[model samples]
Target: MRLKGKVALVAGAGTGIGAATARRFVAEGASVVLTGRRPGPLAEVAADLGEAALAVPADMADTAQAREAVRAGVERFGSLDVVIANAGGHGGNAVADTDDEDWRLSIESNLTTCFVTCREALPALVESKGAIVVVSSIAGLTAGPAVAGYVTTKHALVGLTRSIARDYGPRGVRVNCLCPGWVRTPMADEQMDELVERDGITRDEAYALVTKDVPLRRPATAEEIAAICLFLASPESAIMTGSVIVADGGATAVDLPTLAFA
Candidate 1:
């Protein structure tokens, strides 16, 4: 009931964290507008949410489509109370081998999409004094061997969120970023399989190796991430703004061992 009578727009709502956030929002009494590249998956989620959900198929990378998606949501729900810029992907490329195309694509997919959606939704959010929750990643804070493009783009979002929050918090618009670690989503599963094939290891071994740095010894669940987003979107976090909340199971807290010391 925290979101009762609120209107929310969730991008990338076809699966994973986006889908989980949509479902959680609807359950809390918010009428949701769910958008994703695939119409089938969006429609399925909307159907499951009953009358409170609207499925709007869109590719967030397209600036025009992203703007129209926000506009359509406002048209249906009368006003917009929350916006979740959750559409992004990881492009695997080492810094040495990354091409301009790969870097640009990663920027467009992760950072540009959030920029477009937030710009489009700003007017409506200002009118309603709503909150914006951006879904970033733990890679934004820590470094890895590969995924240079992904790491940079995710880090860029944190900066953008803070800037927007600083400028608009006085105007009653709250903006925050949620940085999640490895989560058991379809995308994570694909990454795990790719590691297995690349490293010639069993699936279990691949998962364990990847999560070895995490103190929890396992990845987070989609619902767990959704719950955090819900709290941020609700009045419970009214005093919170320009915050970077990390849900990484302490993966980034561990220090790498020095060769000389070892």
Candidate 2:
């Protein structure tokens, strides 16, 4: 309800956090334009949200498509009050195993998409004095094992968030990064499958294996992350900008040696 009368552009809205955010925004009395690479899922989400939502399929990694998504959203919704750059994915085997394409795709999906979304939405966002909540990862704040390309791109999003916030804060646009740890989403599910296959373990075992380091002892739900995005997108987080908010179940708070003692 905090976002009553607002309009938001949510990239990667085909599913997971993006879909969840679109739902949350609608429930809070906002009009949402959902954009993603997949039209099927995006259409499904748009249908679910009824008249409050519109789906536009766009690959945010491309500048032209990113611009068009914003344009279409504005044309339908009249103005933009928030932009959620929630599109991203993992890449690379490890630093030693990663190839050029791995790095390129990772950067495109995770970092470039975010930059392009913010760039295209800034003019409208400035007019509306709106907010931009970028979805980075806990890896952005701290390194993770065997995900070199993902780690690099997420870390870069932190810088992008801060830079955007600093440059545009005085212009009435707010920018902040959400550093989420493990979450129960399609991306995380894919990673779980990879872990299971790589280690020859069951699905539950793979989940526990990855979540053992989390203080909460489980992965976050997409709704949980979306709730934070709602807060950041609303006036409740008015005092916060350029903040790297970590909602990782305390994964980054513990010292590795301390964990060993535990």
Query: Per-residue lDDT tens digits of candidate 2, residues 45-129?
Result: 9999998998989998888988898889889889999999999885657888998888888888899999999998999999999
Quantify how close model 2 is to the true structure by its C-alpha RMSD in Å: 1.3
Q: Could you give candidate 1's per-residue lDDT for residues 1-262 as a string of tens digits?
A: 9999999999889999999999999989999999888999999999999889999998877878988888888888899999999998956779988898998888988999888888888999999999999999987788667899999999999999999999999899999999999898988888899888999998778778878767887788999999999999999999999999999888887666742453
Best by TM-score: 2
Give candidate 2's TM-score.
0.96
The lowest-lDDT stretch of 10 consecutive residues in candidate 1 is 253-262
Q: Could you estimate the TM-score for every candidate?
A: 0.94, 0.96
Error of 2 at 96 (Å): 2.6
Error of 1 at 154 (Å): 0.5
Task: Please give the distance, in angstroms, between residue 28's alpha carbon in candidate 2 and its true position after superposition.
Answer: 0.5
Residue 63 accuracy (lDDT) in model 2:
86
